[model samples]
Target: MPIRVKLDDMLHERRLTLSELSARVDITLANLSVLKTGKAKAIRFSTLEAICRELDCKPGDILDYSAED
Candidate 1:
């Protein structure tokens, strides 16, 4: 995947647990775990918005893109 999920890093930086973020973002732990582990194929804009709102961050704080070698 060209896009990398930086969710774990952001969570760590913010000192938030997965459960806390899930609750605040109104998302399931399973779904958030998948996203956290970079296993999600896609994410809805609404969900992204909720996460950003809860985390007080931009999308760039949770996602990154890099070129393939």
Candidate 2:
């Protein structure tokens, strides 16, 4: 995928666990795990907003894009 998820890096930088983040965002661990592993097909704006709010980061901090060939 051209879009890469940097969730792990953010979690490490913020010293947060996935379980904690899941709770803060009110998202299921299963769904967050899929996103964390770069396996999610899509993410809703509301969910992203909640994550950003809890993590004190921007969408760019969590997601990055690169040209694929």
Candidate 3:
């Protein structure tokens, strides 16, 4: 996957638990966990907005693009 998920890092930096983030973002823990673990195939912009707002971060903070070798 060229796109990497940085959710765990941001969460750790903010000292936030997955459950806390889920509640804050109004997303289910299971769904958020899938995203945090890089198992989610896609994310809606609305969901992204909620997450960014709650975490006070940009999409780049949670997602990154990398070239394949």
Candidate 4:
């Protein structure tokens, strides 16, 4: 995928664990782990909003495009 998820880095920078983020955003740990590992195929707008809200970050901070082969 050209789109890379930077969720792990964001979490580290914010000093938050996946479980903590899940609790704050009301998302399941499995789902958040999928996103953190870049294994998720899609993300709903509501999910994105919740993550951003809890992380105090923008969508771009969680996801970015990488044109590497």
Poorest lDDT segment (10 consecutive residues) of candidate 3: 46-55
lDDT of model 2 at residue 34? Answer: 99
Q: Candidate 3: lDDT over CA atoms? A: 0.94
lDDT of 3 by residue, 1-69 (tens): 899999999999999999999999899999999999999999999989998998899999999999999
lDDT of each: 0.95, 0.97, 0.94, 0.95
- Across residues 1-69, which tens digit of lDDT does each residue of candidate 4 receive? 999999999999999999999999999999999999999999999999999998899999999998988
Cα RMSD to the true fold for all candidates: 0.6, 0.6, 0.7, 0.7
Clash number for every model?
Answer: 0, 0, 0, 0
Cα TM-score per model: 0.96, 0.97, 0.95, 0.95
What TM-score would you give candidate 1 relative to the actual structure? 0.96
lDDT of 2 by residue, 1-69 (tens): 999999999999999999999999999999999999999999999989999999999999999999999
**Candidate 2 error regions (>4 Å):** none
By TM-score, how accurate is candidate 4? 0.95
Which pairs of residues have clashing backbones in candidate 2?
none
Q: How do all the candidates rank in terms of lDDT, highest first?
A: 2, 4, 1, 3
Candidate 3 TM-score, C-alpha based: 0.95
Error of 2 at 38 (Å): 0.6
Q: Give candidate 1's whole-model lDDT.
A: 0.95
Name model 4 segments beyond 4 Å from true: none
Candidate 1 on 1-46: residue-level lDDT in tens? 9899999999998999999999898899999999999999999999
Model 1 — which ten-residue stretch has the worst lDDT?
Answer: 47-56
Candidates 1 and 3 compared: the better one by TM-score is 1
